[model samples]
Target: MTHTPLLKPVWLSMTLLLVWLLSACQRETDLVEPTTNTTVSNTAENETINKWILENMRDYYYWNDKIPASPDLTLAPSDFFDSLLYTYSATAAPDGDRFSWIEENADDLSASLSGESTTTGLEFMLYLRSQGSTDVIAQVLYVLPNSPAARAGFKRGDIISKVNGQPITTTNYASLLYSGATNYSFGLAEVQNSALVDTDKTLSVTATVFQANPVFLDSIYTAGTKTVGYLVYNQFVPAPNNSSGTEYDDQVDAIFSNFKARGVNELILDLRYNPGGYTSSSANLASLIGKNISTSSVYFREEWNSTLTPYIKQEYGDEFFVQRFLNKSQNIGGNLQRVFVLTTDGTASSSELIINGLRPYMTVTTIGTTTYGKNVGSITIVDDSGKIKWGMQPIVFKSFNSQGQSDYSAGFAPSIEVQEPLVLKPLGDITEPLLNEALYQITGNRLARRAVATGHSLPALGSSIQRKAGGGRMIKSLTAFKTAKLPQ
Candidate 1:
């Protein structure tokens, strides 16, 4: 009918439509016939990345010999990398070889190693109203300075009853709190008459990127003639971008300096909530506490995989095997005979390192529940080429303290077993159960106990809450290496 009409406007439109169809066909053809050079380049680049990963794993992985001889390289990088891990048998222990992991972004991993992250600036412990109860309650454990939670006027011991206007239950608690939300609405609660009661007050907080200072709380407590330095040392991370320098060292020095000035004799390191950090920072903190220990003394030793052990021994010598205590100017040199370490399941890695490393030099009395058992450490490995952003945090070595003790795979049992109570108190508060026990151990004075709701144990909290927060302390080595220039 259109052809019969033969209108000038219709004829022109038909011609234009034909031309447009031809152009679209040509474009599709061009896309299908990609250049050989580009195809070859992509394949070559992927091969290069795969090769780099394999080589690094062979060199640095704790179980280098256990890696598959011929990995399926055609698989995705993350999958291929995981396939090489030492597979655990059904009969073997659960945590046989689960520490090694890979990160897509190396820069972010590096930043995290230095204790920098986007956070709400809040660290809280989730607890059931009672054992076996689905009704969950969160007690603010500590707040990082300059964090959104702190800005929102959140203080430790503030109970969180509801999240996003919904009552916090075991089912939705993890998703509500740690789902990486940019904003959060927290409904406050308080324990009245030994029961959790909802309050009218609510606070909204937005997460922001901030550098967390590892030194959470520090105070010099005086009980009679005993001057005790109590430090809530959260992590072993050094100051941001100043890991090589004394930026973090200076902070520790300042605290100890104040302690020294005040003639603080006894030391109580509270690693109750500390998940580990930099190994070097751990060594530094240990050196400051055990100032009388010789700088030449081996604080800790690293045991690499059998493949690289011989080469490392040859290149770096025996001294390289062990990390020695540094004789820094800031070392307080208090020469305390015994030190009390406040611990929980959260106390792990470098926190445990400080405890284990200092044991040969001093009496480390561990209080609270068992310490997180991680004697192994990891090194950050990044792609040599700027093309790939992938990073690998492979377990490189098993660390042994001065006495060659790395046997804490099942966690270090507390000398004085005490569980964190359901009713919480502010950090450094003598009335807090953990701190109270520590002080009682120190001064032999039983401070009046704060009334707590009975039937709360760490195992219940560990099961309900810790499982949601990605359970246990993930300790990363302060050490970093490039893919191209890995140590022998």
Candidate 2:
């Protein structure tokens, strides 16, 4: 079955529901009692919002039939919303609904979707020096450009031993690292005599509103006769304000354009720390890398619920269900046959979508660890009233590649499996283990390996650590609407 478009029939479904609810309210006049205008207005508004939520769920939710037919409308919106999730069975193990969430402010939610957030702009990995030990050390992953952390001279591979003069332990790391503090003092350290020794150097950083640019790092490398292009894309966010003409996407296009001019024959896409974003951006990236693929060929497919399936089929036709590769002037449709993808647990959603979507057209070799398996996408819904800005992001559809494969909930395994090295190496450095592995595969020549200094080795951090630090596979959502609207 073909999948639905990211541009869903949300307004159409919402309008039909509102019309039905207005008719029902007229018929059930007895239920609403005569009261003060203020009280009556509040009650009516709540009823309208509740009715709209239910109707949208019925029409667009992936498990629409599982929603109860007679849920209490007077309950708090959050509680009422939870009661509608598909919980499977009481005896079954809990696979919590981690995706669906309601935002109190639609504007804030919209900003977050556009990759704007307040932070010190630091992405790091935490590791325990010994198994089950409290001595936890953090290795800097990558710092966002123009961020507070970046201004403080923090870079990839910097070891952080202490925060605010307190040593980092498993018990207190959460409070010290992720307690949403505005200002923090970090102590630099190095391995000395088999122990983490503070170098007496301290740097303080203040968290501020930082616009996270998804295109973190992009460069072209010369490996003998092969010109390799490497891009460290952190998210799949499109241009801000939902503007057309590829404002954000043009950043990528410009990079590929340089690669095309440079006669680049190989591509290395680094999504190691990406947690997914807009689906349209993913499709665009796939198109740029898939040089030989035809624009008319299907990139991915979507599946919707049964009740609205035929209606969508009749309304938008078969083409609406399948996203095809876009033909663009900047696309690097070069002499390449295979692409290399660098992934970790943080690689998810549209990241996985790009990996899966490109497989049918080219040879994709994934390095590093397995991916975060998320074959589903969501749409954001807000109430009709401009007063209440509450927005709902619910998983509405599951996506599949052209080959009809979407069973990768467990994640995609790496073709060349290698864990990120505990001994820090600067990103984009040829000596970096993951990048070195990719170069080895591309050039058929092994690069010289550097010996790790004794006492620098640390225990492998569990996936749970990544999850606790908000570094694993993420819930990907689609916000493709040209403008916010109410169901008229």
Top candidate when judged by TM-score against the true structure: 1
Give model 1's TM-score versus the native structure. 0.82
List ranges where model 2 is wrong by over 4 Å: 1-52, 72-76, 87-97, 169-172, 193-195, 241-245, 446-488
Clashes per candidate, residues 3 or more apart or on different chains: 0, 3
Q: Give the TM-scores of the predictions, in the order they appear.
A: 0.82, 0.81
Candidate 1, residues 1-488: lDDT per residue as tens digits? 11111111100000000000111111110111223454555556555656767877777678888888988665456666767777435477354454555555666656655667677887777678666788887888778877888889999878888988999897887578756678889999987887779999999998887788778889988878888888988666667743556587678878887888888888888988766766667777888888577778888888878776766556556776678998865555554778899988777677788878888887889988887677776666665445667666666778888888988866789998888766667889887887777788778783335323232552234322132111222343323211122343
The 10-residue segment of model 2 with minimum total lDDT is 13-22
Q: What tens-digit string does per-residue lDDT give for candidate 2 at 329-396? A: 66775668799999886677778888889998889999888886767666667654465556666667
Output the TM-score of candidate 2: 0.81
